[model samples]
Target: MPSSLSGRTVLVTGATSGIGYESARQLSERGATVLVHGRTPEEARAATDRLIAAAGADAARLRPVSADFARLEDVERLAEAVVRDHPRLHALVNNAAMAAPERHTLTEDGNEIAFQVNFLAHYLLTNLLEPALTSEPGGRVVNVSSSLHRAAAIQWNDPQRIRRYSRLAAYAQSQLALTVFAADPRVTAVSVDPGICATGLLPLYGHEGMPAAEGAAHVVHLCDPSTEIVNGAYYDRSTRVAPAAAATDDRTVKRLTKLADLLVGHTA
Candidate 1:
């Protein structure tokens, strides 16, 4: 094991498979105590087993947690549990997100599924876990976003795409909102474009991408304490690049943050 991340703790969401799993594995191997999160207990356990297999003697550093992002209540519970269990979190990898659904689906929270899962749930979780993250020096929050966000507009009046629905549109919008949210000066946050990887989410685009490990590398780099990357910047596979115009607009960021707080039922 590298011991590069020794003594640090990182929570990687969506660790059951693909980039998320690979990210968790890489982090664990690098000596970070990794919390592997999945949508179900079974999935979480399976991911933990895989991570352990990869970590060998360092396997003890991997733990499992599950939460269904489609449900706001479940997201809330997950946040509360993390806050209660890990008081000195060093990093949070908000990597759990689904490809666009075939149709517009609404979560139990009455918000669009993509918006809630990809953006709002993370919005709530980061705020809830802010204390643990800020308590330690060099705390980092890595949000796995996409280059697809370049095509997105907030659609503020119809943020949910309730009137019209397209999987790509919804996914792009959600990613854009997340990137904008990362711009907040309060958190050491950075949004990453994992570069199209051969993950299950790629099938939605009717094609395969690079290997999942390649995509995970982008995330692992950002989490490394040695990286001198600027906070609140967007990166395209290790190279910082300009994000969509909306992501840089201060008014838009604040509006989206306020809207996200309202949607998540949180104040301030």
Candidate 2:
């Protein structure tokens, strides 16, 4: 393990693979105790094992928590467990998201699949974890967003996409909103676009992008407080990037905050 983040407890969602896996790996190797979160128990277990091995079990610490983000109830429950168990959370990396390929599908809670999984669930998770974030001195909430947010469609009144769904629009809007909201007090929230990353998210566009490790580097940078300065700034790779027009608007932030309050409701 390297240094700087020694003894810190970090939680990373979507640790099963891709950017989440790499961020967990790098953080763990650098002496932070990583809480590896995944939707499935089996996959979470596998990711935990890989991270422990990659960073050396004694050198790296890990905790596995599983919850399906598509279901808000599960996210709330997961948030409860983490808060009760780990109060001094140092970093929260909200890297879990889904990109729907076709017309919007409803989630278990009757919300749009892309919006529910990409933004709302993450928002719920972060709000639930806010105490832990502010408990210590402060914490970082790094949201893995994308550059496509420039063309995002924020159908604020209809996150369920009841009107109609453009797959890319759904994805971009959700990411943009997520990054924007993470910039709350005592939380250094930043969204970073893993530009054209070679993940499972691009089947609709017929494009596969850069290697997952290459795309994950900036996420790790966000976790490392040394490279952290601009509290709510969006990042592209390592450089700072601007969010969408909506992401920079206070009206949208207030609306999203209210929606989050109504949605989370201390359930967990």
Candidate 1, residue 106: lDDT:
89
Predicted structure 1: clash tally: 0
**TM-score of the candidate numbered 1?**
0.96
Q: What is the lDDT of candidate 1?
A: 0.87
Best by lDDT: 1
What does candidate 1's lDDT look like per residue over 166-211, in tens digits?
Answer: 9889998999988998897777999999988888889655586998
- Candidate 2 on 1-268: residue-level lDDT in tens? 3346787888999988888888888787777888889898888888898776764654338888899988888998899999999998988998998886586688778777877788888888887888998897658788888777777767767876778778777887777778768665446688887667777776644576788888777787777767645677887787785667677677777777777666545333
Candidate 2 stretches greater than 4 Å from native? 53-60, 204-208, 264-268
| Stretches of model 1 off by over 4 angstroms after superposition | 1-3, 54-57, 204-206
lDDT to native, each model: 0.87, 0.78
Clashing pairs in 1: none
